[model samples]
Target: MRRSIFETEHEQLRDTAHDFFLKYAVPHRAEWEAQGHVGREIWRQAAEHGLLGLEIPEEYGGAGIHDYRFNAVVIEEAARTRSGVALTLQNEIVAPYLIGLGTEEQKQRWLPGMATGELLGAIAMSEPGAGSDLAGIRTSARRDGDGWVVNGSKTFISGGLLADVVIVVARTDPEAGHKGFSLLLVEDGMAGFERGKKLDKVGQRTSDTMELFFSDVRVPAGNLLGEQGRGFYSLMRNLPQERLGIAVAGLASAEHAYAVTAEYARTREAFGQPIASFQVNRHALSEMHTKLQVARTYLDQCILGVSSGELTAEDAAGAKWWITELEWEVVDRCMQMFGGYGYINEYEISQIWRDARIQRLYGGTTEIMKDLVGRKLGF
Candidate 1:
């Protein structure tokens, strides 16, 4: 699809990003998957290539660009490569919590390193029992004189094993309902801030996911991300962008899967005739192509809505759930056309199929997204 949202500069950015992923990420897939995490060098290399910080201000060693299309381009490129690169989400999606809510002092202290890739950041919001229910988290941060002592654990956190700074969500006042929660920036080297074993997963193995433990870890009062008792509101404010990010990834992956399958159908033979000649295969391909085109239109509109500050949480939820579900569906059907070859790990289709599964589960489950949209409809 010829997207109208991007200009020549964005096109150049896409080309550059595609080249970078081809060079640094593609060749290292097997090694990273075996190790269960990507190398830290890739992070710094991304920063050096000007791919790490698109939203950070120039004063903070970033480009300071306000466009979300560029961010979408990055996500799309990551999906195209299927290398499970997630730094863009860390930088553009999660880091905004501090950018929007942190004090000037906090920005001055963290933004530069974050932009330069010297410090990797992660947000700790989900607990073992709390996947979609943000209010059900049991992590606690108790006031202790000038500092707050945090306790509890976060599971399935992106960059959990490697993050230099983790924005931890905890209940500061158990009785205050949602108002009791706060976000505390937990830095590395802090007492009782330990990481659990790296998790094994079915897909996106190059992306780090692990458990974080905070047992009486002391965080200064100044480390608070925003107003006391307003962390829930602050988090809700950024979710639209996160869901948009996921949509961007899903559509890109679907497109790649379709493109690959189309080529396979043309070359691979069945009964001495190219599979592309068969009516059934042709119809399936046409349907997938049509779905992708339609989904891309809605996704581009969502991107513009978000960039223009007009996107609602409900629209984002709709995009996240719908696009990701489509992504998995399209990829699975494409893989089926590949026959037994798709099941082998050596094939990119197999990897794409595995990687697409988590899109509906993470960020937000499809069921949770429906509930969110339902609530917006006054349900």
Candidate 2:
């Protein structure tokens, strides 16, 4: 399917982004994976390339483009190259929240550094007990004289080790249910802000995921983002873009998986003939092609709708759940086609298959997405 969403400008940006990934990211994949995180220099290199702040305002060291398709392009290419942490997520997932909700003083203090890669950002939302149930989080911030005393724990935080500033979600008023939540920015070097061990994960090996502990960590009143007790609403507002981003990567992974498997099938032989010549292999290829094409068409339209501010949360949820689930399915089936070789780390398919597992789990689970969609339908 032909995608009409991107203009010539976006196309040019894609080419540039693609080249950047190939040069800086592809060569370091193995080392980064071995080190358990991407090198910090890559973040600086990306900032030099003007890839970190496309949505930020011009005065704040960004391109000032508010369009989402440009953001989508960066994520798509990053996933295509399997770029590691602090590349795609910093720009697409975490940056926008600060851009959209942070105060002018906050923006002045953080945006320039963020764009220049002098500062790294991470959002702390998921707790050990609460994944999708935002209202159930027990992390609390009690009001003090001139600041808030924040004490809590956050697990599964991306960029946790490298984050210079973390936007933490906590309950400001325990009895208010959803209305009690708020967002606070806790900077590095703050007293009593302790980082836990980097977790061992099944995939996304190079992306640092860590646990964070706040033991009487005091955040200044000015560090609060938006209205106190309004963080849930704020989270809800931004979740659509997050889901859209996941959808972008999910389908891209599917397409890449299919492409790689197709190449392998053509070269590997069975019964003195290429596996690609077999009817079973041909049928599998046909099905994968059809599924990916349909998913791509839908996701491209969602990207356009998001760029124009016409995309709804329900629409994004549907795309995220359906497309990522499809990515998991296609990658698994494609892996099976490789026989035992698919399970080996040396094969790119194995890595992709492992990496694709979180697609259905993160950015809200497929079950949560369906529930959101169901609620939008008045269920």
Candidate 3:
């Protein structure tokens, strides 16, 4: 089914993003995967093309476009190339926090570098003991004489090794329970702020993920984001968009897998004929195509809802888990169709399968999303 949500300008942007990825990311995938992270040069190239900071105001050297369709285009095109650069994290997740909550001075200090890819951003929320339970975070920031002293560690922080600045979620008043959390800006090279080794992952090998440690790191009072004691609320408010972005990427990955597998079935022969001629393969393809179409339609609706400010947390959760689960299922079936060849590391289907596993686990697990939606339905 054709998607109707994007305007002509969005298609043009998609073309630009596709060309940029093909030129910069596709050829370097092997090297990047070997290094366990993409090079900063590609990020700078993307910034040159106006791919970063779409939400930042023009006065701060960003595109200043608030539309989500542009973001969806970048996600889709990046998925098409299988680039594990984490651009969605930069544009979709972290940008909103800064653009929505940062003070004018903070904006002036950070937005330009963010827009130009000089200052990459990462949000540190999950800890070893706390993944979905935001209120259980133990990272603490105590009030000091003109600054706050932060002390804690975060694990599984994407871009941790390369992030120029990290927005650390810390407990400001342990007695206040959930109301005690606040966000502090912790910059690179700050005393007592250090990054641990890059983590080895099952997939998305080209994206950097690591541990971050902060001990006695003093953050100025001006580095505080939004109102104190409202960090949890701010995270909740931005999660819908983050989940929607994940859903879009999941749908795109499924679609790409289906397309490539369909072509492979038509060419790769079994039983002295193309596998696509077999009833089982034909039925599998038909089923996957139908499922992907349905996912795309629903994802499109969610994107529109988000763009129009009508999307709810429950709705985004539904889209995230359902679409990502479907993505994993579709990719798994596609891999099976390739038989022995799909098990090989050289095959893209195998990588897609590996990468799809993490989608259900992150941005809130599938179980967590179901619980969230169920509660919203009063179950």
Candidate 4:
């Protein structure tokens, strides 16, 4: 069960992150949940503590560490703590687009603020008409003199409510089909950019989820990310990393669930003995533990594959679907050990269960991931 992924530095990072979240983030979870969004203060605090932008360059106010394991440590610690902040959304989902695609001028304008956590980023993909169907996206950007005029809306935008910069996916050439799509950087207070109502979700209440409205907003040509009409491919390239992030989160949450449940079974009694003393309960815990270890092994390989640029979309899809589905089962089984307390909103397991549901849905639905992998297998 010992992980070979972390070096001494990685463990050092994990220890510091664990301590910081235990002190700062865990204590504020309730208050942040009440607001339905994490405060910018927490983001700034994380940055000040040197936890927010490990992948960004030092010139841009970051540690300039390119290792993905370091990134995984941040994500794993966040999930383990149930911090309710979507660091994955920022670090895994949006940072690459900025780092890999941003022009020197664009980097100058945005990267420093991002690395410093002064600017939060979000990638707007799903629309009112498109969730899994990227081809169905209706958000459009038309070429205007010296700029592009964008018009459309995005929903289910993670980190939307507070993002200082939103990387919007829009159709740039109506006739080019899939190649028509492009990424546009829409900054805060852009003339026609508006944050819609904060969505009320069943879980992960502290992470902001919302709709975004863009009405004939003029984005300077300079703000376009990557080559125009290459957005779809760009997004596809990033999907592997994004899905891997989800898988790691799934593993972390499930592991946390198991730890909590195992401790409960050891202490909570039934028939004058601990519930764990029962054969059926013991078997259930054993199965969940074995499943978790297996999951970690494969996921660790996927992490290494991704870090080495050798992980294929198919491999990432397999990890995302299998691990998330297993995550759900593991958490559900763990919750059963708590009996009625599992259903109570007060228990930590209850929140973990609620939050785990979306893992299979977002990034890519389990069904979609299966089909993707199936197709790659000559199905």
Off-target runs (Cα >4 Å) in candidate 2 are none
RMSD of 4: 0.9
Model 3 C-alpha lDDT per residue in residues 212-316, reported as the tens digit of each score: 999899999999999999999999999889988888889989999999899999999977999999999999999999998888888898888877999899999
lDDT per residue for candidate 4 within 267-372, as digits (tens), equals 9998999999999999999999999999999999988887788899999999999999999999999888899999999999999999999998999899999999
- Estimate the TM-score of every prediction: 0.98, 0.98, 0.99, 0.98
Question: What's the TM for model 3?
Answer: 0.99
Model 4: per-residue Cα lDDT at residue 101: 92
Tally clashes: model 1.
0
How many clashing pairs does model 2 include? Answer: 0
Ranked candidates (lDDT, high to low)? 4, 3, 2, 1
Q: What is the C-alpha RMSD of each candidate to the true structure, in Å?
A: 0.9, 1.0, 0.8, 0.9
Q: What is the lDDT of residue 163 in candidate 3?
A: 89
Q: lDDT: which is higher, 1 or 3?
A: 3
Q: Count of backbone clashes for each model?
A: 0, 0, 0, 0
On TM-score, the stronger of 2 and 3 is: 3
Write one digit per residue (lDDT tens) for candidate 2, span 236-310. Answer: 998898888989988988888998999999999989999988998899899989988888888888998987888
What lDDT score is found at residue 238 in candidate 1? 88
Compared with the true structure, the alpha-carbon lDDT of candidate 3 equals: 0.91
